[model samples]
Target: MRHRLAELRGPGVPAKALDARALAALAANPGCGRRALLDGAGVDKASLAERLGAPAPFGQSQFALTRGNAFEARVKADGGAELLRLAHEALDRGAEPPARARLPDLTATGPEGRAARTALALREATAEAGSWTLLDHPMLALEVAGSPAFLEPDAVVVHPDGRWTVVEIKSFPMLDGAADAAKVGAAARQAAVYVLALERVAAHLAGPPEGPAGAGAPRVRHRVLLVCPKDFSNLPAASAVDVRRQRAVTARQLARLTRVEDIAAALPEGVCFSPELPPEELTAAVEAVPAAYAPECLATCELAFHCRGRSRAAGAVTPLGRPVRAELGGLTTVDDVLAAARGEAGDPDDPVVAALRRAATLREQALREAAEVAACR
Candidate 1:
């Protein structure tokens, strides 16, 4: 299966490994088995999507990546002086500014080695109670759908009082003391993944499970520091965002994502996701894996348009949105919905059917009234 997935990358194009943001977005639409299987197998979804005639703009340009890195560097300049100062001012003004913060080396060969290094750094930072420690680009591992996902947060701060904070530095500006709400929400979701990963690490650490002052017991605070450019300036400003609810929801959803092994076990015989296959073959292979397409997937999933085309062609009710689909009862397709609306099928007494009939009648009356008014005019 690994070999088969490797072949799906088209001989040279590297597989787009799932990142924290991708995983979070996958969780945002948790109803797609197609997405789960492809993502878990590290399939080149964008390639498949292109073959299916819907090329998603998921590729981040190197210039944008470099610009983001530069922005983060400017914010974390001078040994993270501005970041920590903003953190203090935003989170705890009473606490004195951190002097002489420790920056540990988290360099390692791979995600596994980096995660181990990060854990070690956290432990050592926790032990030193008199000073502050900043972990930059710390790789944290999370178990998602029975697989390990490595997440690197912008920075993690271990305060003197035995508390840890997640610092999220974004290139987006905090204009007029506020940032884009949607962007902030996305950042919060990404940070929530980090917080959950840290909690998993904390759960395995030694000591009384809860260290002195409950430090050992998952010291990750729910309120994380979100630093962005202050009103178009290169200087960064920070705001404390409480992601407790998002954390709980994301943690639950991540755990509930269908495991790749199970999805593979259920695949039809002789179906491979090789990118070398013809477009028709690829489409057939993808279609074999069922998907729950929704309107929300347009902004997130690469395969959304492919799935949507299939759904619309099949008249599947899900493409119209979940609420409309829910009101349809067992009618899971557009044809069924139309049949009910036209009084050609379904029990008239059924609430869904009855509501549809009433809606249809109202629409007909409104149209007739408008026509009559036009004729009179």
Candidate 2:
């Protein structure tokens, strides 16, 4: 499977590692087979989009990156004493104050080694009974579409009761005890991926004899701590975000995704997505895999622009938005929708067709009334 993925990514091309953000986005749009297959193969979608003449417009500025890094550093300073305190206040109020906690060294050679070390640390922390253990930038592994994706959360804290909580640090300001809802939601989704990865580790530690949530197994908390700057100051503020829904949705989507090997087997021979390939060939390679395009994808996917262009060219009503497409009901193209609205086609008994005709009549009446008023004036 790995060899096949490598071939799809092109000979001698290094595959891009999938991060928590990418995994969250993939989970949010599970119906997009193109994204699932490309991501599973570790293909760089940004580069692919660039070659296809629709470069992705989403990226953080260098200044924003620097500020974010500084904020994260401050939050994690002093062996993460401040971070632990915030976690206690936000998620474990009744427990003993985190005046002192253990910060284990998770440094290792590579991702696999780090993941192993993290698993070991979690086990040790769970065994400590009444101690608080903080792991900074712990590496975790989660399988998506039959591929292993390594995720590193900002921090993971093991509570006295053997409960593990994920901590997300961001530079976005939390004013009046609230941050931007969209940013917070994105953070929650990203953290949900971490929580899911932690559960996999916990399950492994529990073994098959004992179920994942067995007595001795580590417990992954569904509520993750979101730490961000407070108001206009650089001070850190914490909020507990419930991610049970996001975790459940992501888990289900991942479970139902088509395996990378299966998608690869169905592709034509000699198809590759290397940016070095000719433009036409690269386009062909991308088009080989069907995409579920929606306007919502513009914010999350690097290949959204390319997919949007194709969707519009094919007259797919999906570009109008998912909700609009749903309301259109079986009207998959703009031409079909217009024909229905004009009463030239479609079954008159159909509720959707009747609604379209009524809407068209109202629109025409409004336009006519405005024109008549203007002419009178």
Candidate with the greatest lDDT versus the true structure: 2
Screening candidate 1 with a backbone cut-off below 3 angstroms (N, C-alpha, C), the clashing residue pairs are 8-275
lDDT of each residue in 99-165, candidate 2, tens digit only: 8899989999999999999999998887675878899999999999888999999999998877899
TM-score of the candidate numbered 2?
0.94
Report clash pairs, candidate 2: none
TM-score of every candidate relative to the true structure: 0.94, 0.94
Looking at model 1, residue 152 earns an lDDT score of 87
Query: Which structure among the candidates has the greatest TM-score?
Result: 2
Task: Provide the lDDT at 202 for model 2.
Answer: 83
